[model samples]
Target: MVSTSTTGVLVLLGAPLGNPEDASPRLRTELARADVIAAEDTRRLRRLLSELEVVPGAVITSYFEANEAGKTTALLERLHDGKRVAIITDGGMPSVSDPGFRLVKAAVDAGIPITCAPGASAVTTALALSGMPCDRFCFEGFAPRKDGERRRLFTELAEEKRTMVFFESPRRVTDTLRAMAAVFGDDRPAALCRELTKTHEEVRRGGLAALAEGAEADPPRGEITLVVSGWTGPAASEATPEAMAAAVAALEATGTDRKIAMKTVALRFGVSRRDVYEAVLKAD
Candidate 1:
C-alpha cells in the first residue's frame, strides 16, 4: 500500500574509516533525519552515533554481506512506503567493495532516487600517502587469498602501466609482498599503508623485496593498504618472441597449466595466442 507520488530517496552515506572526527556534518544530519538506516555493522553504527552525539530517530537495521541479498528486498519495501532510507558501511562509501551495491542496484531498477554523502576513503587516502604516481591509478581491491591465485593475479598485473592500490590483511601482507616481488620484480617500488587516518598510522615505502623482508621481521597489525608503482619496464608489445616463450616457461615451472601459462604470457606480452604459440615453437 504505497502512493506512486511518494517514492522515497535512498541515501548512501560515507562512513569514516577509523576516526569519528572524519564524519561530515551532512552525514550527521542525514543520519538523524533518515527514516530507516541500514548499516553494515549495527554495533559500529551505534558507536559512531555515540561519537557524533547524534540520536537517530530512524529504525537502524543490519545490512551486511551475509544478509545483504535477503535484506535488500525488505529495504526496498520501505522505500516504496516513501521512507527516507540510508545505507552506511563500517568505513568509506558503501558499495565500493562493500555491501551496498546490491541495494543500490535494486533501488535503481525500482526507480527510486539515490544520493550520496561523500566522505573520507581509505583508497584515496592510501594512494595520496604513498608518494607514487597518482595521476593515473587503479584500485584492485583485496588481492586473492590462495597462493596460486594470488600469484596468477600478480602475474596478470605485471604489465599494468598505471599505479595500483590494493587492500590486504596484515596476516598475509608479507607473503603477498613476496609474491609481488617475484612477479612485479624485487625492485618494484611500493608503499604499505597501515592504520590509515588513525592513531599509530604507519606508511612503509621501498622496493617490494625490502618491504617483504621488513614485514616478515616485524609483522604489522591493523587495516593494511598497499600502493605499488606500476610496470616501468619495456612495454609488452616490444617484447621479443624468445622473451614471450621464456615468460611462459617461467610460469609453467611454477605448476601453472601449460595452456593457461601460454595464455597468461600472451596476455602479458599483448599478443595473440597464435603468436605466443609460434614463439614457443621457435623456442623448442
Candidate 2:
C-alpha cells in the first residue's frame, strides 16, 4: 500500500480525449504527487504517463464501470486515511458517462475534500465543432441501445426547444440518424461529428434526411457525437392562443415572411390559418 503524509483530497482529472499534449500541468503534478491513482484503464493510464513523460510516484489501481462499485470502498478508505486520491479516466472528465462517480459521491458523503482539473470533453468539443447553436444545448449521453426505447426517447424529445447532443456508436450512427429523421422531421438540421480530435475527424452538417443519406453512403468510424437542432414547430400541447401567436412571431423574426410563418405555424399545430389569425389578434 502506498503511504503519504499529504491530506486526503479526491482529485478528478480530465484526461486527454486523444492527444497526450492536452494533459495540463496540474494533471501532471497531481499524478506525480498523488498517494493513490484510480484509473479507468490502468494500461491506458500507464501509456498516457509514458507519453506525457511523467512517472507517477503513486500506486495505480484500475477503476472502471465493472469494478467501480468494488473499488469505491478501498479508494474511500485511502482518502479517509489522509492520502491524496486522484481519479483519471481513459478520456474526458470522470463520472461523465465514465467511472469515478461512486468514489466522488462517497468522498462527498464522508466529508472528504473533492476537486477537479478540467480538461478535454468530447461533448463540448463535438458541440464546438458541430457548427450548431451552442447558446442553449443539452447532452443526452448515449442513446438507448434497444430500438424501442431509443425511439420512445426520441419521440419524447420531439418538442424539446434546446439543441440536443448525443453519443452513439459508429455502427448505430446511420440507424440513429434515420430514426431521428422519422420522429423529429426529415428537414431538422443536424450535425454528425466523428473521430473528434483525431487525424481523421469528420463533421457532416445538413438536415436530418440528408445526413441519414450521407451516413448510408459513407459509414462513419471511431467515436461519434451527434448534434440535432431543436424543435421550432408550432407548440403541440397546452399551447395558449397567445403562445401559438408568439411562435408565429418568432418564425417571422427569422426573416420568414409573416404570412408564410403563420401558414407554416398553423400547419405545424394542425390548425387552419383562420385559427392562427384569431390567435394573432388575441396575442395583440
Candidate 3:
C-alpha cells in the first residue's frame, strides 16, 4: 500500500477532445496542482496546455495504451514517493474508453488518494444531443473493427433498455451506421455527430436508415460519435429463424457480400451463422 503521507493524491483529469471551451476550470486547477502529469499524448497535452493558455513545465510523460502496462509502474513509483500524479487522456475522462484504467486501479489498491476532474464526454454529449432517453445509458466505446466480432458485441447489447452511445472511426462510420440500421431496424432513431465542437461540427438526428444513407452518399471526415435508441425489446416473435434468414438475405441484397452480411444477421437472431446459413439455403 502506498503511504498517503508521502504519496499524496492522484487525480484523473479529463482533457478536451477538441474544443478548448470544453476544458473545465476544475481540470485546469488539477493540472496546475500536479507534481507530475501523465498524458495519453504528450504532444496533444502540449497543444491543450497551449489552448488553455497555460504553459505547463512539470515532468510530463506518455501513458497511452501502447505502453500503459509498463508506464503504470513508473507512475505508481512517483505516487509512492509522495508526489501528486495527475493523469489525463486525450479526451473525455481518463480511463473512460482510454488507457488510464490500469494506473487508476493500481493507485486504488495501494491506498493512494484518487479523484476525477470531470469534463467533456462524447457519450453524454451525444445522448443529450440525440434527444434519446438520458436517464439510463451505456457507452460501448468503439465497436469491434472486424465485422464478425462486431456481431457478437452488439448482440450482447441487443436488449439493453438504456440508450447506447458508440465511438467509431470516420472511415467506418457509414458501414457501422448501416450495421446498426440492420439490427436495430431502419426506423430506429439515431444521431450522428461529426467534428463535434469544431467549426464544421454537425449533428444529424434521424432514423438509422436515413443516417446510413446520408453518410454513405457523402462520407464524413472527422471524429464521429453515435447515440442509438435502445431496443424496447425484440417485439413479439421477432427473434425467429425466418426473421434471421430474412435479415441476412436483405443485407445481401443491399450489396453486402454473403459472409460478412450473414454474421451480422446472426447477431440479430442471437444464433449461429451455420444455423442462419442453413435457413438461408432452405429458404432458397
Candidate 4:
C-alpha cells in the first residue's frame, strides 16, 4: 500500500489508550499506507481498526515480547527491501514496559531511519489526572510480583523526592497499596487510577493507608496506575528536636501508640528512631 519508494524506515506508532477518537489522522494514514505493520497483538490491531473504521492496507504480523528477537531480523530485512514498516501496540507507546525495544535498537544499528507518531500515554494521562505534582516524576513501569522484592524496591524509593508512577494489576493492587503504605508511610498522599480513559475510568485519591483499606474492602478491577506523592525532603532548617517530638505527638493524637508514632515519624523523615524516641521523652 505504500506508494513511495522511501524505505529502510521504522515507525513507532502510539495506539489509543481507550477512546477510539484518540487515534490520529496520521496513524490512520500510516496504517493504510505502510508496507508492513508489526503489532503486539494482530487481533487487537484488527479490533482497533474496526472501531476506527480504518482497515489497514498493509500486512499485519505479531511482534510481541515472546518473539520480538526473531522478528526484528525479518522486519529489518523488509526495511532493507525498501518497505515502510510501522510498529504499534495494543495501548500507548511501545517499549515503555512493553515490546519494541529490540526492533528499535536493531533498526538503529542497521541505519534504518526511525520515527514515531506519538499519541495517548497512560503514564502521562494518569499523572495529569492524579492531581499530583507532574513537573518532576518517574514512571516505575510495574512493581515486582514477589512481595519481598516489591517491598525492597519500595524501601529503596522511600526517600525519592520525585513523584512516582507505577503500573499494577487489579489482583495485586491492594497488596501493592499496603506495601506502599508500609514503606512510604500510611499518611503519604496517593492516587489509584483505574481503567483510565475508559467509560469505567476511576481515580481514587487519598492517604496511602486509607486507600489500602478501601482496596481491601472492595477490590478494584481493570488496568491500574498508582501515583504516590514524593518525599519533599527535609526542610532547609532541618527538623529540630522540638519538631520531631511534635510530629510524634500529632500521630499519637490520631490514636497511634506513642512508641509506634515515634518510629513512624523517624521513618517518614529519614531520621533515627532513637533520636525521635529521645525527643518524645524530653518533650514528655
Whose lDDT is higher: candidate 1's or candidate 3's? 1
* lDDT score, candidate 1, position 250: 64
For 1-284, candidate 2 gives per-residue lDDT tens digits of: 89554558999999998888889999888899899999999999999999988988899999999989999999999997899999999889999989988998898888888999999999989888878789999999998887667766776787788899998888998878877775665678999988777788889999987998998898888888899999877546734687568766755543446676566556557678888889998888
Which pairs of residues collide in model 4?
none
Question: Residue 130 in candidate 1 has what lDDT?
Answer: 94
TM-score of each: 0.84, 0.80, 0.83, 0.83
Q: What TM-score should be assigned to candidate 3? A: 0.83
Query: Of the candidates shown, which would achieve the greatest lDDT relative to the real structure?
Result: 1
Please tell me which model should have the higher lDDT, number 1 or number 4.
1
Error of 1 at 265 (Å): 8.5
Tens digit of per-residue lDDT, candidate 3, span 149-224: 6655665666677889999988889888877776666777889988777789889989988998999888888888
Q: Which is the winner by TM-score between candidate 2 and candidate 3?
A: 3
After TM-score superposition, the amount by which residue 16's alpha carbon in candidate 2 deviates from its true location, in angstroms, is: 1.3
The candidate that achieves the highest TM-score relative to the unseen native structure = 1
lDDT of 2 at 178: 74
Question: How many clashes in each structure?
Answer: 0, 0, 1, 0
- Candidate 4, residues 1-284, lDDT tens digits: the string is 85565556788999998888999998898888898999999998999989878867788999999999999889989998988999999889988888899988888888778989999999999999999999999989899998767766776787788999999999998888877876666678999998888899999999998998999898889889999999876553445788788777655554446776666667667688898888888998
The lDDT of model 2 is 0.84
Residue 114 of candidate 3: its Cα lDDT?
Answer: 94
Q: lDDT rank, highest first?
A: 1, 4, 2, 3
List per-candidate RMSD values in Å: 4.4, 8.9, 4.2, 5.7
Worst 10 residues of 1 by lDDT: 231-240
lDDT of 4 at 130: 90
